[model samples]
Target: MRIAVFTTCLADALYPAVARATVTLLERLGHQAVVPADQTCCGQMHLNTGYWARGLPVVRHHVETFEAALDSCDAVVAPSGSCVGSVRHQHAMVAARYDDDALAERATAVAGRTYELSELLVDVLGVTDVGAWFGHPVTYYPTCHSLRMLRVGDKPVRLLRAVQDIDLIELPGADSCCGFGGTFALKNEATSSAMLTDKVAAVTSTGAQVCSAGDSSCLMHIGGGLSRLRTGIGTLHLAQILASTREHPCPVPEPRRPARRRPSLPGAAR
Candidate 1:
């Protein structure tokens, strides 16, 4: 199958490795992966922030970019469940809100072809194990969008379980949101922090050195909190974990370092 990768904004900016891993996994499975340079954010941030008007252009651009790529690719795939969920669920809503029937129909058609990485691998490609191997204690946290919005249950875990020598641990409160609902964290910092505290505690209790999730946003929040506490646990995208192989094992990521505190001025108190 010829697959086109929809590298979301978060992955493009903060987690390019995850996007690369998605492509690597697809190619390793004997499928071609195409990444169109014209592809940009799916406007999920705008839509989630209630700026449907502002998001329509972004949604339309995405549809146009992929529609063109469809000439060479059989399907569109994204490592992010959140972005896929937006394209599948929110794009059409934006069109309908504005009563753009033509755009709505087009949006629906494009959404139908878009798939989360695990969905494509298991349902479309008909393969569980992609000959991957990652020998370490790891746990998975199902992101909110992937779980509730996309309804991609067990598919990611099923793929992880098939990895050779993988010691997959069950994460306590695996379905709980990691307190990173995009702008929600910024809007409700205190509440977000409290929720993150619980998530980090649950992750630590599993005694897993690494935590994996489908969405980079959640992983960034969870991983950042863990890093601040100096927990020594790392966060990885499912794509990176799945791309690991016996010949080329996924290297354990270095613990994230906390930002350095700036020095006080000469007259200021220490």
Candidate 2:
């Protein structure tokens, strides 16, 4: 299958490894991964922040970029479920909001073919085991958009379980939000931190060496919290884990940052 890789903004700028892994895993499955050079952000940030008029051009550009590329590619795939969620759910809505029925129609066509990493892997590729081997205890956290919005239930787990020699530990409260709703962390720091605290505690309790999730954004938030609390847990994207193989294993991650005291809970012993 010929697939276009939609390297979302966060994956493009902050977590390029996740993007690379997405391509690697696909190619290993014998799929051609084409990354269109002109492709840019899907205007998720603008639409997500309620900037409809401002988001239109960005959405239009994405629709134009991928709709054209889709001419040669069988499907579009991204590592981040958040971005895919935006592509699948927001692009058309934003276009329709501005009364651009034509753009909305185009956006829907592009989105109809776009899939998140797990969605592409399990649903489209029609395979769970992609010949991966990772001999470590890892827990998978299902990102919110992928879980609630995309409803990509058990696909990620099914893939991880197929990894050779993997100890797939179950994450407590795995479906809870990591509180990194893009700008939500910055806008609501206290609430976000509290939610992250809960998530970090749950991850640490899993006794897994690494915390893995489908979205890098959530992993960043969870990783930061785990680092501060010195849980010694490293965060890895799902693609990275799936990309790992016995002969060419994933690189050893850098040591986690030093620990800090956990935030004091109300009426709780510190």
Candidate 3:
């Protein structure tokens, strides 16, 4: 089972480790993972921020990159629900919005084959426990795009539950948004901060050693708050958690300071 990885914007720039862990999990399962070196942002941020027309080129580039990869790969997978949600649900809409029916059809075809990491493991591969070991008290947060947009309900939890020696705790208000809606955090700083405060409290109340989510963007947001408050709880992506094994365990990531790289998404093919 050869799979292609579509490493999204945040993961590519800010959290390459998460993308690498996705490949590690796939290879550990005896499936070959190939990264289509040309893939980049699926124009999700452009569309989300009201640059629908400008996003069409990004959308078209995404469709072209993966459409080529799908020629030989069994499936396309990413660790991000937000980017996958855009590919699956928004790519075609961006095309059709400008009367590009040919591009729209191509985007739809590409969208059909893309999957988030957990969905690929659970639904496509029919394996919940991918022979992983974590051995830590962890709580899982389902990001908004994966929860509402992708409807990947409980698939991540199912994967986490199967880890060896892992003590999974229930997150308080698990379904509530972490308030990291990309630019929403920037545009409405006070509201976003307030939401983040609530989310941090909920995460702390769980008494888990780490907070886990499928999206790196959300983890970064939650992690920054945890760092500022000097909470010992760390953040780990689901792929990293699943990629953890006794032979080569994933070290608990320290809460990152707000100082990080500015995301510059090139045509990773634009």
Candidate 4:
């Protein structure tokens, strides 16, 4: 199968390795992976930030970039569920706002070929284990957009469970948001911080060395909170874990001091 990797803007800038891992995992599974250079932001940040007028050009750029690859490849996969959701769910809304009939048509075609990592793996590739070999207990944080908007429940968890040497733990309150809704963080700083504190507390409660999810943007936000608190817990994207093997291990942050105690959930902490 010919597949194109749409490395979202956040991944391109902050998590390039995640993008590489996504391609590596696909190729290891005996498929062709393509990275279209022109791919950029999926206009999700803008769309969510209520900058519809400012998002049109970005929407156009992304649509054009992915449309070419979508026409050629059997599927277009992204490591980010959020980005895939944007392309699949929001492109039509954005296109319609401008009344650009061509853009709207192109948006529909492009969105059709895009799939989040788990969707491609379990739905298209028909495999749970991507033959991963990460040896550690990992906790999961389901990103809000992917969980609520995309409704990509259990796809990631199912794949994680299939990996050899992986101990997947249930994150208490795993469905709660990580408080990083793009501009939501900036617009409501205190509320965001409070919410992030709750998420970090949940991460610490997991007593696992790593916290992972399908979205890197959420990881960045959660990682930043953990980093700030000087907690040793690390955040990883699910693709990174799925891509790990005994030969080529997923790059994890070096271990620091183990957490002193599992943090209690809000209102329950003593």
> What is the RMSD, in Å, between candidate 2 and the native fold over all Cα?
5.1
lDDT of model 1 at residue 31? 95
lDDT of candidate 3 over 92-191, digit per residue (tens): 9889989999999999888888899999999999999899999999999999999999999999999999999999999989999998899999999999
After TM-score superposition, what is the CA distance of residue 216 in candidate 2 from its true location, in Å? Answer: 0.7
| Model 2 regions more than 4 Å off | 257-270
The residue pairs in collision within model 3 are: 267-270
Q: Tell me the TM-score of model 1.
A: 0.94
For residues 1-270, could you state the per-residue lDDT of candidate 4 as single tens digits? 999999898889988889988999999999999999887888898898889888889989998888788777998999988898888888888889889888988888888888899989999999997899889889998888778777888999999999898878898888878888888899999999999999999989887889999999889899988888878888888888988999989877753554578778989947
Report RMSD (Å) for each prediction in the order shown.
Answer: 4.7, 5.1, 10.0, 5.8
Q: What is the number of residue pairs that collide in model 2?
A: 0
Candidate 4 residue spans exceeding 4 A from truth: 255-270
TM-score to native of every candidate shown = 0.94, 0.94, 0.94, 0.93
| Least well predicted 10-residue stretch by lDDT in candidate 1 | 252-261
Give the distance in Å from residue 238's predicted Cα in candidate 1 to where it truly belongs: 0.3
Residue 202, candidate 1: alpha-carbon lDDT: 98
